[model samples]
Target: MANLGLLIIRLVVGLTFVGHGAQKLFGWFGGTGVTKTGEWLESIGIKPGGTIWAICAGLFELVGGLLFSAGVLTPIGAALITIIMIDAIVSVHGRNGYWLTNNGFEYNFVLIAVVIGVALIGPGDYVLFYRP
Candidate 1:
């Protein structure tokens, strides 16, 4: 039951990130693709946001989400999620206060906490791979 809960959490969060990454990288899922994503990043003051940053972020989200969902190298996956979410908080949400309605860091913070908690708790017994 506990493992089932972990699996559900991992799948939901990880797949959502994967979709977001696809949006940024390939324009799938209604995303504007790399060029537009880069433009948005640049607008947010992330330099070289046109392509390089977009690719980097997309890879981070895509690969990290994959690893997280698969329960492989869970620490690395959690670290990636943490880094990206922190960037989001610093780059965009920090100024909006704590409510999502205000475009704040609340959602990012919850994600960070969830990933960190899962990492600490171990990916559980239902993982695709177990690192002994």
Candidate 2:
């Protein structure tokens, strides 16, 4: 039952991340694609060029989400997710306060916490791939 719970969480969170990445990478799902994503990244101070960062971030989220959902290299996926969320918080959300309604860090924080929890808890039994 716990494993079932874990699977559900991973699927929801992971797939959501995939969609987010697609939005950034390919402009799918109503996203602005690389150009706009890059501009936004620059607007938020990501630095060194928004296009590069956008691609990097998009790849990280897309691949990380896929790995996370498949339960393959779960820790790595969690780490990737964690890094990006932390970046989002510091670069964009931290100054907005805690409540998401204010465009704050709340969402990013939750994502960080959830991925950390998933990392500590193991990917559970329904995984398509397992490291140990």
Candidate 3:
């Protein structure tokens, strides 16, 4: 019962993060490649003028998302995402305030909490992958 809930949350969040990473890493979901994304990052003052940050973000989101979903390296996964969300709250969402309707940090804050929850509570044994 509880395990199912945990598994679902982990996987859904992990897959979502992976999808986001894929967008940047491989341009799978209309995500710009590292080169273009690098430029975009520079504009936003979020990423430096190189592909490293982009690569890191993509990998984190990609790998973090996957591990988070599968309940593998879950603490690390949640930590990675929690940190990222913190940055998001600090960098972008801070000025927006709370509440998605007003374009605020509420959603980002919630996500950060979720990631932290995953990290702390971990999967409830419903993990379907990473058999080892």
**If both were scored by lDDT, which would come out higher, candidate 1 or candidate 3?**
1
Q: What are the per-model C-alpha RMSD values against the true structure?
A: 1.3, 1.4, 2.0
The whole-model lDDT of each prediction reads: 0.90, 0.90, 0.80
lDDT of 2 by residue, 1-132 (tens): 999999999999998888989999999999999999999988877776999999989988998899888888888999999998988888888899999999999999998899889989899999995446
Q: State the lDDT of candidate 3 residue by residue for 1-132, as single tens digits.
A: 788888778878889999988998888888897887777767778745447778877888888888888888888888788777776677667887888887788877888888887788867776756453
The 10 consecutive residues of candidate 3 with the worst lDDT sum are: 123-132
Candidate 2, residue 129: the lDDT equals 55
Task: Give the distance in Å from residue 39's predicted Cα in candidate 1 to where it truly belongs.
Answer: 1.1
TM-score-wise, the better of 1 and 3 is 1
User: Considering lDDT, which of the candidate structures 2 and 3 is the better prediction for this target?
Assistant: 2
Assess the local accuracy of residue 100 in candidate 2 as a C-alpha lDDT between 0 and 100: 99
The ten-residue window of minimal lDDT in model 2 covers 123-132
lDDT of 1: 0.90
Off by over 4 Å in 3: 128-132
What RMSD does model 2 have? 1.4
